[model samples]
Target: MSERVMSGSVDGLITLEAADALWADLTADSAVPTASGAFTCSPAHARMGYVLLGGHAVTTVSASGGQWSVLEVEVRRAAAALNSVGMDRRDLVRIGPFRGAPRLECDEETPLRWRQRIAGELQEPGGPGLAARRAAGRPYHLAGIDWRQMLVEQTRDRTQRTWWLPRAVVRLLDAAEHAETQWVQTTRTRQAGAAAAGAPAPRPYNEELRGQLYSVLSRKPGTARKVAGWACAVCRTAPAAVLDHCHEHGYVRAPLCQSCNTQERPDHLYSNDIRVANHYTRLFHTDTDDWLRHWHRCPGCRARTTLPLPHLAAWTAHIACRSLRPTHRAPRGRKPCGVLRVSWTGSQNTPRSCLITVAVDCCPSGEHRVLAQVSYREAAERFRVWLAETAPAVAAAAGPDRLDGLPAQLRPVIADTDGEGLALF
Candidate 1:
């Protein structure tokens, strides 16, 4: 339909038909992608609160306007104020200069409900969402929201650590990884061609690969028929989507997220390499695994502990930031946890591996010694008589991996009102 016709009336209020058309489009599919694609502003329009998303989703736009009514604000700042709500905002739409941009505040009920929604908005992808961000010492963004007239309502009484990976993001990550995994298989044929041709090198092939890669991988995606049980090789927070391959080797090295895929940092990648080297060593990191592992008897350092792991991380970092503080106190403010100190045993070890000794400390007053000594190869390689390959179970759960005996605070599934909390992401 023509923009003029869709606009309906001279007054800012959209024609009932335009509103109905928007509702129809949203009900059948979604208007989010339509708005996002066209979301932009020139300096002239920037003063009309155009820097922010006029409205990004069916739940977020409006005609009466609220904070978006302000002359200027950062986009991300405005995004904090905008989120999905139980009620619909697409039905009452106003127009912005771009193909789509709309803000809503026609009713006080929406903003009040919005506040309640933000408090409960724990599943925001790219978390901690605005709520969690505020809990983590970031400003709580409110649009159409005036801080002076209100009292603060913490989204959740307890601050939940990031444990549950948002299924929406996970779905995107899964597609990206699956597409790349397919690329890994398909490009084997193209590898020699691209490498041998040398000059132009598969630029077109690479572009085409990335373009097709985001069908389900895009922010607003298409069909997601496949999912690989893979997390981002780096952050592991979300699923890996980008296929990072060396041009010389046509096969893929790692699949990454949109953020990591774009911001190729040497330090972060280098840290990832080290993290990979130490991936098997589970005692150093902060996830529940590191603290939890110390609870039971390890064959290496069979000392039983007096405390639980947050015994030690939190109660499961969920909607409520349930801070599970340990009773034990550090005298000098050092971390009151086990000491996983490592020392190499000797150089005369076998050609395949060498030994290292770990000095362990189970937290009590003075000392009980339990040392875990393990082996590794400075440079490692493997030769196998039998070659076995594995693929992820097609029906495997795509949500966060299962946790056993962890605190309820860490469990996002505990707060699931929609029944999808425990299911695949």
Candidate 2:
């Protein structure tokens, strides 16, 4: 009969169940049955010499001459079972002749020792030790075994320090180390590239934007064309075919749609155009009716009436005022406050003059009320007089509590002043 010596150390200590199963299978084929049957070997004779070095047996075995035959088939079966639970030959300290006995070297007895060994091994330019090499070669039996748990296990015997680990667990650790190295390399490359291109280093989180910026800086035709076809940076409402950039600093800012790109002043910065566009966009969406109503209001005829399209066009050409929406609160159970605006007019013969006006829907009456219409100087003077007259009454009424029994309009002006006093414009 052809015979081959089959022996290897587990990376970590073996469990009772694994040891029992392995011993049972090995001696099952024996003709004579002892009291312990298959597990008739001591810690030393069984090739697990670590037991002799103070490690306790996981499974109970009767005292008998350790003469169990280790068939190649039985050893392979034991290896497979250990692998299934994330234990493999990589965990072995030594494996040789059965009679000579395998050496269970106890180098890394504690977690601190294991860590130190790993660190030292990694620092070496040469390949890893025998344990690491075997681990890398072993196949993963279980799909997602927790490699960390395999690294350390609680021993039943306090005397036993070092244990074996599976090859699969070692392979996982190798892969993790490789990934970290690759990430460091990639980050350094990006920083170098950014510095060469005179661009700011990209943030780690903004991967997409960083890539886009790199493409722009490198002047990649395909990427630039693709970027130009993307949605507008300003509104994101239309396809941005125009590439916008700062004239002073020659770097591409962003792709803006045709409309946004076209609305710019000759001498003013592009940011000014963006601000104006944003203001109008907000105004148009917020108060569409107000925009249309004031589009062609005749200054001479103060009535709130809509004009025909043709007349409205003419009226807008003649008008010098821009109407603004009121921000003040109206009395409860009343119509909303009306337009508060300023107008300016000048001619060859006339000096430039500003007209500040306030109009509102007066309480107790639904009629349109023009509260004030005065020159800028006159408005300032009136404001000063109002402040002087109202400051003392406001200070007297103001307390730690809400002012009770005051008119809604006056209460908002006094009590709800946000530390800046009455916000009436």
Candidate 3:
């Protein structure tokens, strides 16, 4: 390999000279021949243990959109080359424009396509989705005709600190290589390898969220023009209002609403459980018949057995069913009762009969309670409250003006009814 070390900064960003040089050195080696007759590149270490190579290619016209057709052929050919060397497209961390421009949208789709494929292939492992990870802090790119990438091992542990890896070394290695595309022999001799196996590409959750978020987005002040242009053509909404990426879990969750900044679960129960429940009932109420059609299923069992539930007889009975459950032992907050319990006795003459009891005081005044059930509106209200407490940043971002500039497709999910709260789904 050549002894030249690539390094330095152009403006403030660390230049990738070493990575560029390494690409040239490695490609020159007979061991790593440039297979494609059109593509060219240089290699460098973009980050510690993260290698990068820069290259470009030309494409002949095809039936599909011109730009898209080139991207498909180039990426597929690149994937084939990488596979020959025991690496694959999944190893490609990012691809960005370097020299000649290929297409504008190609830069965005390259990373997205790679991520979608990786998510589908590694779906079973269940880590953070590539898009969310990149959104949080992962850097990947593809800029026009110039394709630049930082490759890393899939299973490598990243828990250790990266301070020891000098930025200069990575930059020095990235600057050296430059070449033209050429075809080489198929690197993968094994026909049964996993890399060759292909499946339908996975859909991006962020893209889907962008489309559904507009209902809320339209409400933003600046989005009015965008909405008018769309001809009211948008649909779909996420189950949660503020969509923040969860790095550990890899999916976005409801963070908060732009309007109320409420959490999904209400803390009002702490101040006055009965009062909050009552207030919720008055705001958006529902009855037994309403539940029979709408919300009767036990979220726990996924079963529609509300008819057999003896706890429906009284508010205390229903509360008892939720209280007595062992998992309900943890108190959400101060309440009239610490928990609820349900017990049953069966007889041949009668079907199973059950009773519900509150583990703590029902009320100090001993006032009789009325016949009422937990309303879906109440549940949604609590969700708003829960989101308020847990994701305050999201709550702050829910103002009417904050969403003004976003595209109609990127709006939030707004609720339909008055005081109905934000509809996430």
Candidate 4:
């Protein structure tokens, strides 16, 4: 990746010759692809290409690596937008954050192009250029390893630069290897089998690929509902697959595909990092831990949450004694906590307009289900104390940082900076 090529080598006129110079395009190497489906583009071949995603044209310029580079860029852009890195903080679209927060985003922008032409290429198995498309229309990703997703998490964690990346990547591969027995796979299979035997799967779940991922604004449950009555919220060609809900809160979000179900479960972190962090930043977790205290003055539980997949609700309690607070019993020993599902509703803001249901489930079950949440500025204030305490340590964790890498043009337009380094709440 460090190798440099001449400007003429990158231009379209000399591209073929350049491709041959950097990569063994004429040889067998050109035919082979890396584990991630990266091909042997000639080192001299700086890539400029476009791919269609969800019916939209995605064009980007990659320095060395071909198509793979483009995908990596997308993941970073997503995280950069989420963290508001060199971007408007107002543009960030945060749905919610738990093990099951559905989506996160910011105003999209045309991704930046690599200023220098480097030496890396990724192509399909069909080979490079026209030949690849002739064989397979879409690019391939390693099974179970969503590289773009892994990178989105990597990009968010500015705290650990290159140090943790290898471990994260290795965990992703390990997960792929062991995916067959995992709950994400097995549970889907079990549910699918039940449906095949004539369970009431409703409409959305009946259609579409059995296991696709999804996101939506509403976190309402989507089961037993007639699909024909309404269209399931989806961003892909696939229709709704099934309902999505937070197992902890017992609140349904939307009808989701198999793909979305897997994303909702950050418990994948306990067995495998998969390199995918939660929707919140590392700083967010740190803040929640130090604050967000329980009303009864029990353990915060926030600190109990783990990372690289974090912001997951930690086990909480109203009192020090778990014996008095048993969870509700369910079929599986793991399913029930002998806790109660005590809930009621009331207004938060306008009379009867902004209704808020506060459930005081003192069951010591880790899931703290609050129906209403505070405004952004109010929530942001909650973190200010923590941010101030750690600002010195964060700033002093010295070395080349994410801010230093941004192009100067991006700083003013997208990045908002203050005296305390690159502050993206």
Best by lDDT: 2
Q: Rank the candidates by lDDT, best first.
A: 2, 4, 1, 3
Sliding window of 10 residues with minimal summed lDDT for model 4: 112-121
Instruction: Give per-model TM-scores.
Output: 0.20, 0.16, 0.18, 0.22
What value does the lDDT take at residue 415 in candidate 1? 17
Model 2: residues with Cα > 4 Å off, grouped in runs: 1-218, 264-425
- Candidates 2 and 4 compared: the better one by lDDT is 2
Scanning candidate 3 in windows of ten residues, the lowest lDDT window is 177-186
lDDT of 1 by residue, 327-349 (tens): 25567664534333333333322
Q: Each prediction's Cα lDDT score?
A: 0.27, 0.31, 0.26, 0.27
Model 2 clashes, total count: 11
Residues 1-425 of candidate 4: C-alpha lDDT, one tens digit per residue: 11332343333322322322322222223111222222222211124343222112223355554422333333223223222212222222111111223322211221211101100112224322333344442432232122222221222356531111123333333333333223233454477777787643334323332112222322235422333232343333333444543221222334544343343333222221111233223223443332222100111111111111112221111111223333566666533233222211221112233221222233446665443333323322333333335443432322223233222221111121211110111
The lDDT, on a scale of 0 to 1, for candidate 3 is: 0.26
Candidate 1 regions off by >4 Å?
1-63, 69-240, 244-251, 254-370, 375-425
Candidate 3, residues 1-425, lDDT tens digits: the string is 34442232222222233323433344443222332212121111121112222233323222223211122333334334433432223212121111221111221212213223333333335332443244422322221111222223233276421111112212112221111101100112123245656622222223333312323443455432222122111112211123322111122222222111221112111111311223223212333232221111111111212222221222333332334423222357444342232222331113223222223323344433332333333333343353345444433444334443333332222222211111111
